[model samples]
Target: MNPGASQEPAQPTPGKHARHPKAGSISQPLLFAASTYALGQVANFLFQLRLLYLLGPSQYGETGLAHLLLVTLIFLADLGYSSLFLRESGNSPDWQHTWRYALGHRLAATTVLLAASALGWQLWGSEGASQEYLLWAAPACLLALFNYSSPMIAEGRRLAGLLVTQVAWPAALLFWYLLQDSLAQSMAATAGLSVSLGYLVQALVNVFCSRQLKLWLPLVGKGQIGAAVHLSLIGICGTLHDRLTPFLLAPLAPTFLPFFLILNHVLSGLSGIQAQLARLLLPTANTAPGQARILTVASLLLWGTATVLLAGLLIKDLALFTGQRPWLGLAAIVIFAWGISASSGVLATLLISARLEGRLMRLLVIGMTDSALLQIGAAWAGDAGYLLWARMAGVLAILVWQLKLLKLRFGLAGLTTLALSLLACVADATDWAMTIGTVLLLPILIGLLRQAPCYLPARRAGAHP
Candidate 1:
């Protein structure tokens, strides 16, 4: 018998108690998944607030930098192998065999990431880079390395596990914060260690939950490794764009780094909203072409408007809370630019479901190239202000090119969303403007929220209303 085939279970005899394994047998209901996800988000948001309060801006920035680097390096190192494993796990007759194979890849990638992080820090680290950061960050990175590639098919339970993971960091940090005087440790060090402990907890929970997951499992054949690599290459631009911006900004404008990091976190929350919307709606959109367009435009309208309001309010509140009011204007500018870029992401998801990958790829490449060119030009000129503006211009260029490539024409709702997103740039110009924007947006948002439930089922039933 083949080595990989050996992991396949023997057929059960035909009897009253005979049972067969099914893919996703352990998966939980959608309601449970949604509830867990919301809980995780709330936990994470509170943690960020606590983090800002506990660690002063400087220390918070340092910890954030290290955390981002670890995350980016791990994702880059994984090279889409985890994603490939996820797809294969649902289809393979012997997923345990596939799991072992993916585990081997994951281990290799983790090793590479650790080495790269160490070498990069040694060469380029700031003088303030502390031993405590590394002491904690290393284990945290390793613990999180194999998380997304878990062999568990239990999405709902997995989400609950993740909520535990999310809560763990904040809960640990709060404990450390309270004990700082007794422990004789700096806030930065404790914060780092707390998050590390959180990762450790997550890894432990994952192991316990996934009983089939074991280090000793024998590795199987190289199943679709090439395809994984190909997917990674295709997505490399997005990963770099997402992760490397902070690195670039840090060297040029050290003072702005912390604020930028805060904004990035806020944007991540926004991305989560978009991801959930896409996940919930894309399936229905794929079923009916006419409804897809209607649903797509409506999603963009609701999402875009909500983002503008949320971005403005959150940035304003965060600035006041953190005593970093100077950064509010910059936040608005970033939000305005990214609002357009984000619309493209929403549309891309809907369009991809319609089988337009080739056009999407072409448009993405062009947009990225244009953005890079603008960034380089601005950097070369040594004008930080211009560099920021150039970045926004690049984002606008991307939105334009993407729409052209996808041949998307906006109806009244879509055009209104674009206009509102555009006007969001001025939200930070004055306190009154922000307040007015909020007031005007409240009813639209309320209406959208009320109509949201109807959209999923009604749209799926071929009624746009």
Candidate 2:
């Protein structure tokens, strides 16, 4: 372990969140992680843009769908062992042993998922040799799964694994796409193969950096399995919340799927900001003990809400320029859902860090049940607008429950941010002039700015009540 790293997890009291590490201690890793992740996402975006140009909208949507399915499958295969490892083994002296044990179960699970995917492809796939592509996608997903928690477990002490995982895979994937002269098979199949090769390259580089490539071990204790499975239940529920929109849209309104996919792709890039923030804060949670101050919680929500509003407005203009005007209402709903999810996710991370995973998972299960019911009703209604609205309502339901658990409230800063977000959504959904939206939001924006001093260093002193 790196010098001064904690040798045991911090045990905060029940019903409280983790304390923040000193800003200076976390600043370097936060900067390094943010910059590298941004670069990697840029490469990924360029790769997607190139693919869309090469294959056109309809085929691009298929490729995106295939990618989403493969990603979800990988998460399902994970079964939460890696998450359990991050939560438990972060301060273990024999961390490598714990990693190997978790990895062994992950490999076993991956094998089963791969077999199931192959069987489903053979039975349902329309294109020839698509199963071959599926095989390629598996290794890529496996490598990604292995590397997912490396940075977190390292606790920002060594970022070499993170640099390799974030920058190398996407850059190599883009490079491979550039080298391909033409697609010998369908675009989706070719993309699967190319992406898999890129992951292989990533794994090779990571192994060289770490000086080991060991995977599984005979460490299948019942306690380990049960704990990991419990965590995986939470993961699967979160997955349902995120991927459900596309899943429901694909079959019910095939024609609208591409537009939603396009929006998804763009919005996902913006969501990375929140993902990285969670990652940066997670290490603090593992190492420190105390409840988060109100200022910190409020700032987190405000920042997340502001990001979604900005991203929504920007995407709205992009849609108009691309002549996708009719889909702006759909965009509004998607953006609104993202804002709620983003805020809720930060709180969820805090709860999980506090060893409240079981509680969080139960809430997620309840939320998913509600969402599934709403989605089914929307599908029966046979209107795409209603389907999206139903999904957003479901997301809002989750956020409301989370607030109750955390005992957070919409203070002035939060309320202003919320108003601005809603205003942006209304403008897009109603086809109001962009200037009208901006002018209306200015007062709320000014109020949010005035309240920003509450987040400054001076405001964070004393214990969180």
Predicted structure 2, TM vs. truth: 0.80
Winner by lDDT: 2
Considering every candidate listed, which one attains the maximal TM-score? 2
166 in model 1: Cα distance from truth in Å?
A: 4.0
RMSD of each: 9.8, 5.8
lDDT of 2: 0.61
Please give me the total number of clashing residue pairs in predicted model 2. 0
Which segments of candidate 1 are over 4 A away from where they belong?
A: 1-35, 41-55, 81-86, 89-91, 129-131, 148-186, 215-221, 233-236, 251-253, 276-285, 289-326, 350-366, 382-385, 399-407, 430-465
lDDT values, one for every candidate: 0.55, 0.61
Q: What is the lDDT of residue 434 in candidate 2?
A: 61
Q: Which residue window of length 10 is worst by lDDT in model 1?
A: 9-18
* Candidate 2 lDDT tens digits, 233-330: 88789776778778777777676677787677666665665655565566566443322422344345554555456455555666445676667667
TM-score, per-candidate, Cα-based: 0.72, 0.80
